[model samples]
Target: MARAPWEGDFPDVFVNCKWKSPDAKIICLADHGLYDAAKGQRDMDAALGLLDDIVLEKTVSKLRGLERQYGVKPKLIAPAAQVSESNNALAIGYANWLGHELGWPVDENIFQMKDFSKDKLNGWVRIAHRSTFYGEIDKKTPYVIVDDVITLGGTLADLRSFILGKGGRVIGMSTIASRDGNDVRIRLDTDTQAKLEKSYGSDLAKFCHELLGFDHRGFTDPEADRVLSCSGYVDLRKKIVRGRNEGDASRSKKQAAR
Candidate 1:
């Protein structure tokens, strides 16, 4: 399996992940822009100004690799942007860079609200950032799902379900960073957290401290952490497990196919 950059090179995950292709749809889950700790995320418009050619070149290389490994190249379509931003200039830059390099037209119109919730979504679900979006997703050909980070993949699950329901297929999912998660804490999602606690009587705090890196395992970003904490979604640890499990399953299927 193509291990993420942080996996320490145990073994690369070999899958049908096309890093190169002439035509493919690309979509960024969450805000595809970088998370700056200091200046914070510049609006998508500001992101355009920061995007140098070097970044574009490297991005092209990654996309080509994805296409070669999978089957198609992804023209970045849409991205989750900062709500404070005026426009999708950064997103447009990302899409156009991929489009021009890969010879595909980027679909700039494909997007959703800045953020989504379980109550707001219908059909399938995929985790974008730590949030969830439920609606039309990958339903036709293989599409590319991108995100700035893949912490636990809870958001990705929502994306997966939404895609399946829409009849679209995903060639592969890509992200800037996919932080590891905790398994014990994984049994602590909002849906299953209470059930497991009532059944197994596990202590959430002690478990996170012992097993996961921090008491709040789901959040790696300080700002995101604050956001999640404020939302009262105290069970972020399990999303990592669910995310990894889903990733494992997806890669396993690809491995089996190969």
Candidate 2:
């Protein structure tokens, strides 16, 4: 889809203003379906930064194997995002342990400025609630991203964009688990892009630009699929707009109560 007319020559605030193809390799330990028996236990623990011994061991082992397979010895490890409810993030703990095991330093510079926890959000609501990153980055450092889980992969994508924009190089991303068949890569594929354009035309692009400060190309593969699953542009737009409005109202109520 072409760029919206009003989006000329502007930089995206949360991500890299210039679009680039995804190149980082994804290394996930297990599928989210593995926790089906336990239901919300895994997601709850992950959000609260509670790491089980088995989960930790498995994650580190898988990451080590993937590191060898990829033949990439990253200089630094950066964990993606943070939980609003707690200072300790599961990814941060994972990064620290991985750094010690691999003899690399863990970088804790990037910070998430918002709470966009997927567990509490409804369908396509997350599209309007992208997390923003802030903090210093060391230029030219080869960094690997670590996270507790991946769904739409928007958090990792935003983190990658922030690092790349700040001149750091991201070589790989690792997560403890992800939804089955969810590709953790951030860039939307050409085939999917074509489908979206065909279905929604430039209106989709315009809506994305308005909501996300970027176009549909910034969407992760699963996120693009989620949008495509909608009946039409009207339905998609309504979902996004209503979700955003509800989120704002909820946050406002919380603030007022506080």
Candidate 3:
């Protein structure tokens, strides 16, 4: 039998921010764009297909590497429903699909919110006061939280703390897409930080820290500014192309060896 992808080398998961911790890793599958209901569903479905086709094997390989390195697999979790029109039903569906593929149990009842905050203008300090969790999350298990898309990364930051507060160990984070999909390894250098400070001022920068769970996991400027453009969505297509090209090259090399 052909070797499974996971049986090979470890998959590298490059991300802009490390929202959870140094050991807490992330693997983004595809970029999701904002669209109308019908179009959004279609886009999400296509993105989800990538999970079964490309992401699953890669995820398994990555997890195997992590288990070898850390000695365990992190339990998977995804955000519950939003109480507003922005309810992430599609995202929840994607998470369920992912859990099924991974043979992982998903706990959706970890949080119950009176209402999700509407003031996304600041993009940093809005959600902290809005959502709250009630149920008991398993304190013993290490978790790998999944999301459909990471825009400003505020939700991931909040989710990380929520898991930690419940005594859960979040060892990995994953998303199907991000707003700035191409800028995965976005490092904020001294000059970039200075420019952002000049633009949004010190107070908002502090708020960014707060939004990021005060973990200093690192964040992209476009995401911090909440100004990521639609262009980032193209990166998903590019990723698909790259994956296919690499696969073909590998097959060719193997056949030549035969």
* Candidate 1 runs further than 4 Å off: 1-45, 53-59, 75-93, 114-140, 176-258
lDDT, candidate 1, residue 232?
27
Best by lDDT: 2
* Model 1, C-alpha of 10: deviation from truth (Å): 16
Model 2 TM-score (2 dp): 0.69
Which 10-residue span in candidate 1 carries the lowest summed lDDT? 1-10
Model 3: per-residue Cα lDDT over 154-207, one tens digit each: 455456567666666666666655543332322333454555556555564354
Local accuracy of candidate 1 as per-residue lDDT tens digits, 89-160? 433454454466578555443444443223222212233223323334434445555443344444433343
Query: How does candidate 2 score on lDDT?
Result: 0.59
lDDT of each: 0.38, 0.59, 0.46
Which residue pairs in candidate 2 have backbone atoms (N, alpha carbon, C) closer than 3 angstroms, thus clashing? none
TM-score of each: 0.41, 0.69, 0.51
Please tell me which model should have the higher lDDT, number 2 or number 3: 2
